[model samples]
Target: MIEIVDAVAWLVDLEVETVRTDAVQSFVKQETVFVEVTTNDGNKGIGYSYTIGTGGTSVLAMLREHLLPRLIGADAALVERVWFDLFASTRATTVGAITSLALAAVDTALWDLRCTRAGEPLWRLAGGFRPKVPLYDTEGGWLHLSTDELVAGARASQAAGWPGVKLKVGKPRLDEDVERLTAVRDAVGAGMDIMVDANQSMTQAEARRRAAAFEPLGLSWFEEPLPADDVAGHEALARGTAIPIAVGESMYSVAQFREYLARGAASIVQVDAARVGGITPWLKVAHTAEAFNVHVCPHFLMELHVSLVAAVPNGRYVEHIPQLRAITHGQMRIEDGHAVAPDTPGIGIDWDFDAIDDRRVA
Candidate 1:
């Protein structure tokens, strides 16, 4: 046991080169909440979760005032124990968004510490399921983009050898949504895979309407046309849509995914490592989905997802969003449409702490 440790947290405001918009929100900035823990034996590891722009400081306070006190001088190797300890402490409200989000911050940090001490990369520690993963680009739709900009973004994805791209839908008027998809489809031509995400911005009625309207255009899937929490609505939309129904990303917890699976309401699953309490639960969700014969096309952070997705039989696609490349030491690669995970152990990458943000003792 590398005797228990001390931890620290930092915040970085990562920039989005272009306005990335979807049904529910718009992003021009990404705030990465980074955590680093160091053992008495001089071993250190880094982990991070994104809060985008909300509740990050509140999370920082919770870890310092609550979670970190229990962690110090504890066994560094007891990653799972720590996960459960933190999770159990908050079980009453653990199923809620903030609780899960807080657990995720600790969960990711623990895994990073474990893998670094073991001298293995995160994917390998995560069970070395697959060293590379198939990827789909998420580009070509911002709320304010002109038709040409959207089309060009889609074209860029194809030109870069990406098989598919997700376009933003959920314009207030269904006709506007229809035109956007139509132009993007026509511009990208017949061969590319075009997926649409309403970003959980539409009402069930609106979602159902859009789904029916786009059935003729041959979309790969309709993602979160309604909010993730609306399981019953998702079921209804899933029934109405010609394309597969994809949801996750915003969703937290295995139980939520279990409900989604049991309802048979989702065909394309999007799990995020940082969102579902880190790798441990994320793996459970992937395996759970495997049992149902559903595809796990995990959300962003392709570098971290490749390992988990490879470990399962039903894993499908990794969303390729390159926002973190500037700060992460190892940038992800694409080879014939598959993303090759970095060769280093424990996520095999380093965050440029100085460049992204300054560090502090948590």
Candidate 2:
């Protein structure tokens, strides 16, 4: 059995061209918490988790103070066991962002070690359902863009052969949101699939109203119209409208996803590996969605989610947002509207250590 000898954690800050806005909040910056674990046999694995603009230090603290110490004499291959130990050690923080994100980095690092030991890529090691998965564009759908800019962005994504485009809703007026979606629909035509996300900024009444207005437009799905915790509101909204309600990015555990699925509150499951406590629990959530005959189109981290989505049978779409371009040596392969899983051994990202070091803060 390989024992973890050393574990290190740090923070890296990444910048974007402009602040990315949605219906509820603005993206100030991306702070990624990186973890590297070395095994007794001299094998190493690197893993990371992300935050919008805050809490990276909290995640690092959790890793350094409590979680990393647990790895000292533990079997490196016991990913699930290690994950549970970390979860149990920090039970007070369970169901919260900091605990889940910290566990993600450790669990992911262990999985990376497992895949490396087996000499197999993560997608194949996970299950190998498909080599490639279809992708949809969300980078062009920020809430602050003008009507002209929105239409142009949608057109460009369509021209790039993306099968679908997601637009942000929840403008001050319902008509304004409808008008923007209508413009995009007209520009992209009826054949291209369109989705909308409100980012949990609306009330049940307002979400119902928006769903009614959006029903006739043939949107593929309505994402997070109401708050994520409002299971009753989502169920009511789902029953009232024909559009599929998508949720899960804000949820921190598989149990939360179970509540949404069992109640038929959300039709589309957007499970994020990082948010769900990494790939171990992520696989549980994905298979659970499969049992209910629902599709999984996970949120961000396209570089990693492409592999997870491609590994499961019910996997649907990968959101096209490359957040690691500046720190990774390679890019996700996209051809004919699908993102191909990387064949390299271990987790796909080849971290550029020098660049990451240049930006490291902790």
Candidate 3:
């Protein structure tokens, strides 16, 4: 057993260039909490979690006060055991954001350490289903953009050889959403896949109405039309439309994912690693989706998701959002329309500590 020696964490705030607005909220900035763990055997691994703007300090506090201390003398290779310990430790806040984010930092670090020790990339270590996965662009489609801007963005994505482009929905009138989607579809034609996201802004009845309206457009999927916790609502929405329902970035537990999958609520799973505890449980959730014959198309963190999506057979697409380029040393490789996984021995994130240090807030 490789005994753990010490753990450390810090916060870095990354500012966005554009106003990223959706139906529910706007992304003002990214408050990322980074973690590093060292083993007595002279090995170290890095991990991180993210917030859109607030609550990052709370996650860091959870790590410092509750999670980090427990790792001082434990076996670093026992990632799953340590994860379970952390989950049980936070029984009061089980399956919530702060607890899951804190646990993600520790759990991901252990997986990175394990992969480093074995000298294998995370994709190969996980399953090695494919080295590359298809790409879809979400950066071009914000709710604030006009119909002309949406059309231009979709054309650019299509010209760039990306097979899919996602648009933000949830305007005051359903006709407005339909008009924008229709224009983009007419511009890009039938070959290009157009997905739409509501960002959890609508109720079940509203979502069902929009789903019925959107079915004629031949959209690839309708994302987060209803709240993330509304599994029964999602099941009803799924039954109402021919369009597939994609969800899971907001879900925090494997049991929640199981609930979504077992009831046939979601056709595509958008599980985020940081939100689901870390790589350990993320893989479990991916396999569960595979059992249901659903595709695992994770939300954001494309740098890390490249390897993870490529790791499993059921993995489908990686949402393209460039939030980490300023702090990371290298970019995830993109060839034609698919994203290539990083060959780095650990989790494949190459952080620029100088950049992070300059941006560190707490």
Candidate 4:
């Protein structure tokens, strides 16, 4: 039995080489709270908490003051049970962002340790049914870009062999949003899949209005058109339009995700292993989506998600945003617009302790 010996959290700031802008937020740097767990046997596992802007500090506090103590001396092998206990112990506070983000850090670290001990990659440890997951590009079509830029970005993704490209929507003025969507679709032609994300910027009425306009474009899916918590709003949009609705990054638990699925609120379900409270619940959520016959397209952490998606029978597509490319050593591979998971043991990442040096807080 591998008992957890110690744990620590670090704040990592990865310099963003590109100007990432959208209706919801702007980013000059990507900051994450990374968790490092050590076992009594001298093995170490790494995990991270998602959310780039402000919540990272609170996540760090929760991990330091709450989760790490509960986990120490616990068997790392039984990750699922521990995850359940930890989540249940916080019944009063377990259903929201802080709990999920903190739980994700601890849960992900346990999975990392489990796979490392087994001497196999996470995807293989879980199950290696599929080796490659289809890809899509997201960062290029910033909302601040001009219409010509949008077209250029879409065409570039197509020329590079990607099956799909996602652009941000929710321009304060709805007509400008329509023009940009039309320009990108026309430039990319009918061969490629064009998707738009509103980033939860619009009200229910505005989202419905915009979805109506994009319906004729044959968009693959309209992502996060309404606030994630607005289940009735999303259901209304889904019923009102032919375009499938996609959401998950902001959602924290299977119970929360279940609300959307059970209500027929979302057609495309996105589960980020990092954001959904670790590999245990993440797998459960994926299977849950499967039960509903809904396609599962994970949000990010592609290098890690590829193995997960490949393992799941209902796995659809893995989001391929180049956010981690600039900092990580030997990032995931993109070929003909799809990515194949690495066969190497564990999560297939060797944390560059150097790049993440500054974010370390006692």
Q: Which 10 consecutive residues of model 3 have the lowest summed lDDT?
A: 10-19
Regarding TM-score, does 3 or 4 come out ahead?
3
lDDT of 4 by residue, 312-348 (tens): 8888888777666554687887778888887777777
Worst 10 residues of 4 by lDDT: 353-362
Give the per-residue lDDT of model 2 (tens digit) for 62-82: 999999998898899888888
TM-score for candidate 4, please give it: 0.95
Return the lDDT, model 4, position 255: 91
Q: Kindly give the stretch of ten consecutive residues in candidate 1 with the minimal lDDT sum.
A: 353-362
Q: Which candidate comes out best when scored by lDDT?
A: 3
Model 3, residue 34: what's the lDDT?
88
Counting only residues 3 or more apart in sequence or on different chains, how many pairs clash (N, Cα, C under 3 Å) in candidate 3? 0
Please give, for residues 1-362, the per-residue lDDT of candidate 3 as tens digits: 89999999999999885679999899989999988999998999999989899899999999999999998998998888899988998899987999998898888888889899999999999899999999999988999999999999999998889999999999999999999999999999999999999999999888888888888899999999999988999998898889999999999999999999999999999999999999999999999999999999999889889999999999999999988989989788889999999887999888888999999999
Cand. 1 Cα-lDDT: 0.78
Q: State every prediction's TM-score relative to the real structure.
A: 0.93, 0.99, 0.99, 0.95
Model 3 quality (TM-score): 0.99
Runs in model 1 lying further than 4 Å from the true structure: 358-362
Better of 2 and 4 by TM-score: 2
Q: Candidate 3: misplaced stretches above 4 Å?
A: none
- Please state the error at residue 310 of candidate 4 in Å: 1.8
